[model samples]
Target: MKEHHLKLNVLENSQAFLIEAVSKAIVAENDARNWQFAILNLVQSLELSLKSILAKKHPLFLYENIDNPKHTVSVTKAIERLENPMIGGVKFSEKEKKGMSSAIKLRNDITHHEFDFSVEYAKAQFLRVFGLIVHMFRHHFDIQITDYIDSNFIESLLEIEKSRVVLIEHANTRMQEEGVDSSLVWECSNCLCDSFVADKSKETCYVCGYQTSVEECGKCEDYFYSHDLRSIEHLFETDFCEGQTIVHNSFGYEPISICSDCYVAVQRDIDEQWQQRIEEDEYYHWSVE
Candidate 1:
């Protein structure tokens, strides 16, 4: 058997490293909701550390002679003020504070009590906050050992695949209502050329007997394959479907087409429903543990 010891510190280094290590575990183990929290804890720890250091630098911070307490005087602003007491005038904006406060609340639940981790909420939080860390890293405020992966990569991949599932459920619903023929058509959207599902051969199209030379769509005045609605990710929509993981990992490259403008609308409805599940809050169950 093998064992490893881990620790969190508030005395000197702060608990940021502990949270970060847990985050890596969450991501690797496919525990998204938990991963979301690990990232948040790490960020909050950073903010707290910065504020503490700044408070030490500018001991008179709370008495900066401002008549009103600004909604924007959040942790980051306090940290900066310590570095340059002259700019104690600037503070964290309300938008930044709201995001941070939400993060704090979420982290508290995961850390102090048992909370059901919502992957979407976690993904949303990361997309909102990682912008700051990226900036700090780029400006040399933070040291880099190697290329660190961020949550956006994870969220984007997740969304692309989740969106595909939404599209497929919608197609099945349509098929049940009107049958397959109407639900499935592969004509070139640009030239209205009949699309054939066959091996890509150098030979001319058998339908119109059009060679590779005459491949242009007469309707759109472009090559039938030029507009190439292949841009539409149909992996989930057809038997030609690639596996979910493949499509998920590809991000936008695997975008699915909803066919008509109507189908797009239809798909949108289904997607919203699915998204609601991921984002739905259960505040009633306040027990963190």
Candidate 2:
């Protein structure tokens, strides 16, 4: 039990460091000279947080060779090992894994090459990096890091998001000038960037490199709100969809025609109910025979 507690402490501290790094990165994004350092710190935070997760399972896991004991597991090795369930590692979705790999690539580029880093690129990378961090925290630690983020950091991200939207709109305008259909335009839910070209059978966001999926509403036969859109709410919402009724026809349930507006209202009600239930459960501490 004490060992478990110690591991938890390490994880908590690692997460704290990660949050601090992200906050600093948001600030540095405003200044061209400081932005590179911010990227370095963010990458370092990712590596440390990932290792801490592996360490939580066993301190020996952090070591590359348990017998020789001279080498520690590298960030690349740690991320690769995480895919194997037998090693007590969390399973990452393909997109999440891809995002992590991209961050690693960015770190290498910045460290090894004469890289030309731009504010736009950094903003996109930050979204991907922080998105993965948020996922890992929830799945591995069962903690909400958004609760720990300060208002100023949130405001900074909002500003970046607005810029992203403008960039996307400009790109779309160029595509339209080239005779691309306007109906093929899709907004990226990850960065709130409207740079996705839906003309192809499969579409990906040009700005953030996030993949997009089109879901059809069962009632209207029109495109329904996507899981990516829900990701935005997950990032900003306090409870993270604790009781939200995601309009999916899973588990033999009939699909409903939930407009986006109606879905938002239903999600709000669900969140309220979930909060009340959590409070009641904590107060009662009910035990069943």
Candidate 3:
């Protein structure tokens, strides 16, 4: 067998994958299967873009085992490494992270298992990943995304991106015209848009057709999306640890979730009480003096 040396042309490979991804995306409007492949290519392109950035920092940082140099790190590892302050120091918003994670899951479903996605839903997820590609190209790599893809393809992507805006705007107008309660609407966990209706009987997202169960808030007793609730933790005095010289023995009680609004109100009350205590303490100190 003839021996061959492996060479990693990360940036060039990223450009090529981007080109392929957009080409597939242009044709993907009519073909669902094409959309699946486009998603795969787009995720690969993004992974390579991240690797290219890390490689610029240090080639070894991209590898799982720096000494062996046989296998590279996974996309998840690459993202974590990018955020490391000592390394790339790249930051991503929670929404961006959610998008990347959803894309990776979609890619995995396409590659490793049976999957089904409507054209609109697939495009929505695809756009989320594509947004990251654009971000990495401009912010991290310092390159124009259009440089790799043709102008026509860029226009196609622009059109595709417009679908979400139109869908969201229309949904908003419909809700307003119908006189839907603002408290019943929420930002979707999937599409990250304010198009989810958390009705007591039905919880549905108009933008992405995402559905989940809703819960009643402990304070307001109003129904909200599951993600909108914040888990509440309380410290309780433990009977077992009583009389122990331990520094304020306390145990975390069972967690209970409260709606965002109620949590904010609770926090505000705590802040007011804390301020009052501080003022009283200061007055007492001044009186003693």
The C-alpha RMSD of each candidate to the native structure, in angstroms, is 21.7, 17.7, 9.8
TM-score of each: 0.33, 0.57, 0.69
Predictions ranked by TM-score, top down? 3, 2, 1
Candidate 2 wrong stretches, greater than 4 Å: 169-289
Candidate lDDT values, in order = 0.43, 0.66, 0.78
Please write out the lDDT profile of model 2 over residues 114-140, one tens digit for every residue: 886566566667777876776777777
Candidate no. 2 TM-score: 0.57
- Worst lDDT window (10 residues) for model 2? 228-237
Q: What is the per-residue lDDT of model 3 for residues 1-289, given as tens digits with 9 covering 90 to 100? A: 1111112478778878878988898888857899988989988988888888888788788798889988999999999999999987988899888788888888899999999877766787777778778877788657887677789989988988887799898888878886778988987766667888887655888777789889978777787777678865432223435655332322222346888787776666656666777899999999999
Across 1-289, the per-residue lDDT of candidate 1 in tens digits comes to: 1111111122134334433633453463346755654565556655644443443334234333346534324654554564464743334466556566666666677678877644444544554454444443344335442345455644644563464356445544644464444312333222122332122342232222333322333223333333232233442333334653333322222344323443355456546655664465444345443
Clashes of each: 6, 0, 0
Name the lDDT value of residue 278 in candidate 3.
86
Which window of 10 residues has the lowest lDDT sum in candidate 1?
1-10
User: Which is the better candidate, 1 or 3, if ranked by lDDT?
Assistant: 3
State residue 148's C-alpha deviation in candidate 1, in Å.
7.8
